[model samples]
Target: MAYYKTNKDGDGCCSHSDGKEHSNEHIYEVHGHDKNEHYGESCGGSGTCRCEDTHKEDGVRHNGANASSKCGCGTGHGRSACGCGCEENFGSLKQTAFQFGTAAVFFILGILFAFIFYDIKLFNFLNLKLSSVFFLASWTAAGYKVLFTSFKNILRGKIFDENFLMSIATIGAFCLGEWSEGAAVMLFYNLGELVQNSAVEKSRKSIIGLMDLRPEFARIYNPEDLNGEKLINPESVKIGTLICIKPGEKIPLDGIITEGSADLDTSSMTGESLPRAVKPGDEVLAGFVNLTGVIIVKTERDVQNTAAAKMLRLIENAQNRKAKVERFITAFAKVYTPIVTAAAVLISVIPPILNSLIFSAPLNGFESFSPWISRGLVFLVISCPCAFVISVPLGYFGGIGGAAKKGILIKGADYVDALSKAGAVVLDKTGTLTNGVLSVQKIIPSKGASDTGMITAEQKEVLTYVLVAEAHSGHPIANAIRKYASENLSGTEYEEFKKADIQNYSEIAGKGISGLYKGKPLFAGTESFVSDNLNGGISRSENSLSGTRVYAAFDGKYLGCIVLSDTVKTDSEDAVKELQALGVKRIEMLTGDNEVSAKEIAEKLKIRYSANLLPHEKVERFETISSEIKAENKNNTVIFAGDGINDAPVLARADAGIAMGGVGSDAAIEAADVVLMNDNPVLIAEAVKLSRFTRKIVWENIGLAFFIKIGFLGLGAFGIADMWGAVFADVGVALLAVFNSLRAAKCRKA
Candidate 1:
C-alpha cells in the first residue's frame, strides 16, 4: 500500500473538462517500479475530478490489479449512492441550545399563567374545562405524541412501553384533579428526553472529535491522461495511489512518502509535539496534517484498511457491545414496561370494582368509590420510573465523551469497567517508566587515545562507519548517535540530505552490515561478527559496563568502543511518588536493559523491587506476583503498562497492559489493552484515579436511585406519601443519578 502526491496538470481546470471522454490517457504513475502496469483506481481530486486505476489483488500488498473507478450512485461528479460525492458533511447533534426543552418550558409557563388567570386549582379543575386548554397546550409541546401513541397501541392490544408509562402517569394525575401536576410531569418528561439527547450528543462530540483528525475529502490526479486534471470527493482511492497533498491539509490516506519534502505535525496521531519532516517512501497516517512545504505521498496501506481507521471504528461501536449497571435497567424494561402497563389497567378498573368488596368494611363503600379510584390514580402517577431510565446511560456517555476530549480513546465500555477495577499496576520500564531514549553518555578510549576519548584515526573512522551502519538498522542507540551527530554536524540547522550510493553493501541477517566507507571497504556490527567473519584479532577489554556496545571495524581492523544507555524520564521519580502517595503498593520497574541500568533506575525511583529482564523474564516475574497475590488472597490486581517494541510480550502477559505513550510502535499499540494518548508518566496515576472515580460514580448513582425508590415506594403503598411525593421519589432520584454520573467526566489531571 502507498500514499502519493502526484499532481495532474492542475495549472488549468477549464481546458481539461471538455466532455471529451478521454480513455486511459490521464492516469499517470506516482511511485513504484512500473507505471503502465498499475491499474485505474479511484479519482481523488476535488471540485473537478480525475481517475486512476489501482487494484487490490489477492487482497494483499502488491497483489492488486488495476480497475476502473465506480461510484455506487450514478450521478456525474457527486454520483455515488452513498452521496459521498455530494457536498454533505457529517455533524453531530448539537447540545448548545436545547430546542425540545425550550418549546416545552415556554408551553408549560404559558399554561401555568392561563390556569392562574382562570383561578382553577386541581380539585376545582375537575369540572373546569377552561384549564384543560392549558393542559392540552403543555402536552402537545412536550409529550402529546407519546400519549397518543400509547393509546393507539392499546387499541391494537399491546402496551406502548416507556411511552405508555408516561401517558398513564400523566393522565392519572389529571384524573385525580391535579392539572398543574400533570402538566409538570409531561413538561419535565420532555426535558428528560432533551437531557437524553444532549447526553448522546456529548458522546457524539467526543467520538466524532477523534475523526476530526481525518480530512473531509481527498484530491486525486488522473493517471491515464497527461493533462493536470485533479478531482475531489477523492473517492475511488485505493492503496498505492500517489496523491498530492497541499500544505495544511489533512493526509487523505495512510501511506509512505515517494516525493517532495515537508514538516508533518503528527501530534494529533502520535502525541509527539515536534513536526516531523516527511519525504518520499515515509509512512503517513490518515489524520496528520502536513505542516510545511509541498509533499507528494505514495500510499502504502488502503484507506479503509488502516490500524488507525480500525481503532476509530472500534470506539464508535464500543457502547453497543457493552454497558455499565444500566444494562440491568434496559433488561428490566422489557419486563417492567409490560408489567407497569398491567398495573395501570388494574389501578384504573380494580378500584371501581372493589367498591363493593365484602360489604362490611366502611359503610356505604359504594358511595365512596370515587375516593378509592382517586387514590388508585395517585398510585399510577407515582410509579413511573421514567426519569431514572434515561439518565443512567447518559452518565456513562458523558464519561466517555470527557475522556476523548483529552485524546484518550478507550476501545470499549468493558475497558472502562475494567479500568475501574484496577487495584495494582505493573509497568514495563523501557518506554513507560523511562524515556526510551538510549544515548552515548560516555566513551572509553583505548591506550593513548584522543580527547573525545576515541583512540586512533582508525578508531574514529571505525566508530563513524559502525555508527552510520547501525543508524540504518534503527535502534535507540542508533537514533541517539544519528541525532547527536546531526546536531553537532558542521552545517546549517538541518543540512542538505541525500541517500549514499554504495558498493559491497550487505546486511548480516540479524546483526549489522558491511559496506564501502569513504572509498574503502568497511565493516560495522556486533563484536562477534567483526571477530569471527573478518577473523580479525581485536582488543575489547578497555570498554566497561552499564550500556549497550556498538563496535566498529575499518579496512578490516578493529576500533575502540562506544557505549549506549537508556535515559531515565526526568519526572519519573515524581510520577512514582504520586503513585506511592495514592496508596499504590509494590511499585516496581521491569526492563530488558541490563541489571546495572535497571537497578540504577529502580533506585532513583525508590521502588521496593526491580527486575532486569528479557521478554520471558518479565513474564516470569509477573506470574510470580500473580501467584503470590492469589495465595495470600490479597484481593489485589496486577497491571502492566508499557510502550516499546520489545515490551509486547510482557504487556500481553500482565493483568491489564497499558500501552503508555505509544508514538512509534504499531505492534505495541495492537498488543496492549489500554493506550494512554499523551506520553505522561503522571497519567498512570491519573488513570487509576479515573477508574476509581468512575466506580465511585456508578455506585453512587445506583445507591441514590435504589434508596429513593425503595423509601418512596414503601411510603406511597401505605398512603403516607401523596402523588406529588411519589413524583419526587421517581424523577428526583433519576435526576440525581445523572448528576452523580457526571462526576466521572469531571475528573481532573491532578
Candidate 2:
C-alpha cells in the first residue's frame, strides 16, 4: 500500500485511495487499515448527533446534509423539523410582558366594577352578577393558556402536569361560588408562570449565545480564473478548496493558512484572551475573527466537521442524554403525581365517612362536605413537583453551557456528574504535561564524541547517514535531526549529503525505521533496535541519557546516538498546584519515556509516575488505581488526560477522560469525555470547579422546593390554606427555584 502525507500542520498522515482521504490519526481505513471501523453512521436523530466511527473530516455526514438550507428546519444542521427551531424560548420575555399587559387591563376593570357597583350598591341591576362577569374576564385573560393546555393534555391522555393542577384547583374555587378566590388563584399562578418562563429563557440564552459564532458565508477564490471570487454558504464548500478571509470577517472553516499573515481573535473557540498570529502553514479553526490582513486558507474539513459545528451539535443535543439525577426526578414525578392525587381523594372522602359513621354527626346534603372537598383541591394544587422536575436539568444544562464558554467541551451531562466526583487524575507526559516538540540536545560521534567548536569529517559522515534514514519519515525525532543537520551543516555539505540515493524505506512501529542509503543499509530508532543490528561490536550505555536516545547503524557499524529532549510546558507546575488546591486526591503521570527522564519531570511537578509502559499497560495501571479508589470511596472517579492516538484506550477506559484538544489526535478527541480546547493543564481544575458549582445549584433547588411543598402540604391538610395560598406555594416556589437554577451559568474562575 502506498502512503501519502497531506498538508503539514493540518490532517496528518492521510492516504488517498479510491478518491477518499483516510486520516491516519483518526483510524479511517480506505480499505482495511482500521480494525474498529464499526463507528455507526452520523446521528441525525431527535436528540443525538455524533460523527461516524472511521469517519474522516474530509467526508463528514451531518443531519442537515439532506436539506439545502441552514434554517433549523430539518436541514442537516441536527435540529428538529420545527420551523421555530427545537426551543420555544424566542421572544419569551416579550410574550410574558404581553400576557401581563392583558391581565393587568382586565384585573383593573374587574376591581373598578366590584368597588363602585357591587360594594357601594350604586347600580342595582344585578350588580353582583355584573361584578362576577368582570372577574371572569380577568381570569380568562390570565389563565387562558393554562385552561386550554390542560384540557388538550387530558384529551391526549397525558394528565397531571402543573397546568392541569392549577386549572382544576381554580375551577373548583369558582364552582364553590368563591369567584374572587378563583380569579386571584389564576392571577397569581399566571404571574408565577411568567417569572419561571423568564428565568428559563435567561439561562437558555447563555447557550444560544454561541450561535453568533457561525459564519454566514465563505469567500472562495478560483485559482484557474485569476479574477474569479465568489461568496458561498460555508456548508457548500468542499475540502481542499481555497478560501480567502478578509479582515474583520469570521473564519468559516478549519484550514491551513496558505497565503498572508494576520492576528486572529480565537476567544470564541479557545477562550484565550489574546489574539493569535497566523502565517503560512499554521492551522486555523472556524469561528475565529481575522483581526488584520487578508489570508488565503485551504479548507481541510467540511463545514459539518468544523469545530464550531461540532460544538453546536453537542450543546443542542445535551438535554437528551439525561443525567442520573434528571432521570431519577423524571421517574419520581411520574409516581409522585398519582400518589398525591390519591391521597387528596382519600382526605376528601374518609373524613365524611368517619364523621357520619363514628361520630353520628348531622349530615347536610352536599354542602356538609363542600369545605373538605375545597381543601382537597388545594392539596392537589400544592403537590405538583414542577420545581424539582424542571430546575434540576436546567441547572445541569447551565453548567454545560458555562463550561463551553470557558472552551471546555463536555459531551454529556453525565460526564459533568463524573467530573464532580473525580478523586484522581492520570496525565500523559509527552503532550499533556510537556510540549511534544522534540529538539536536538546533543549529538555524539563514535570517533570524536567530545568535539564542540567545529563539525569534524566523522561527525558529518554520521549525521549524513542518520539524515538519509530519517528523510522520508514525519516523526518528531526525525524532524528534529533534519532540523539540526540543516542548521549545523553548510549548504554545500547538506546538498551533497541529500544527493545520496535511498530505497526500500519502511517503518517499524514502536522502534524505528530503516532503508538502503547509497545502496548500503542504514537504520534509526531506539537504542535496542540499533544495538541488535550491530554484530556485538558496539554496546553504548543508555542509562546516562536523560532524554530520548536515537541510535543509528550504517553498513553494520554503530554510528553513535542523537539525544533529543522535549521541554515541559511553562504552565505544567502551576496546573498541578491548582489541581491539588481544588481537592484532587491523587495526581499521577504515565509515560513511555525512560525512567530517568520520566522521574526527573515527575519530581519537578511533585506527582507520582509510572514509567516505561506501552499503550495497553497504561490502561491496566489506570484500572488498578481506579479499583483501589472505588474500594475506598465508591463515589470517587478516575480521570485520564492524554493527547495521542495511542492514548484512546486508556482515555475511554477511565471514568472521565480529558484530552488536550489543541494538539491532540482525532482519535483521542473522540474517545475523551471532556476536551479542553486549549492545551492547558489548568483547565482540568476549572472543569471540576464548574461541575461542583452546578451540582450545588441543583441541590439547592431541590431542597427549596421540598421545604416549601412540605409546609404547604401540612397547611392544606389542616384547612389553614386556601386555593390562593396553594397557588403561591406551588407555582411561586417553582418560579423561585428556577431563578436559583440560573446561578449555574454565573460560575466564576477558581
Which candidate number would show the highest TM-score if scored against the true structure? 2
Instruction: Give the number of the best model, judged by lDDT.
Output: 2
Candidate 2 residue pairs in clash (backbone atoms < 3 Å) = 39-53, 63-76, 64-75, 64-76, 64-77, 65-76
RMSD of each: 10.7, 10.3
Model 2: residues with Cα > 4 Å off, grouped in runs:
1-79, 82-86, 91-97, 111-131, 184-188, 222-228, 446-448, 456-462, 490-505, 515-521, 532-534, 537-542, 662-665
What are the lDDT figures for the candidates, one per model? 0.58, 0.75
Could you tell me which 10 consecutive residues in candidate 1 have the lowest summed lDDT?
84-93
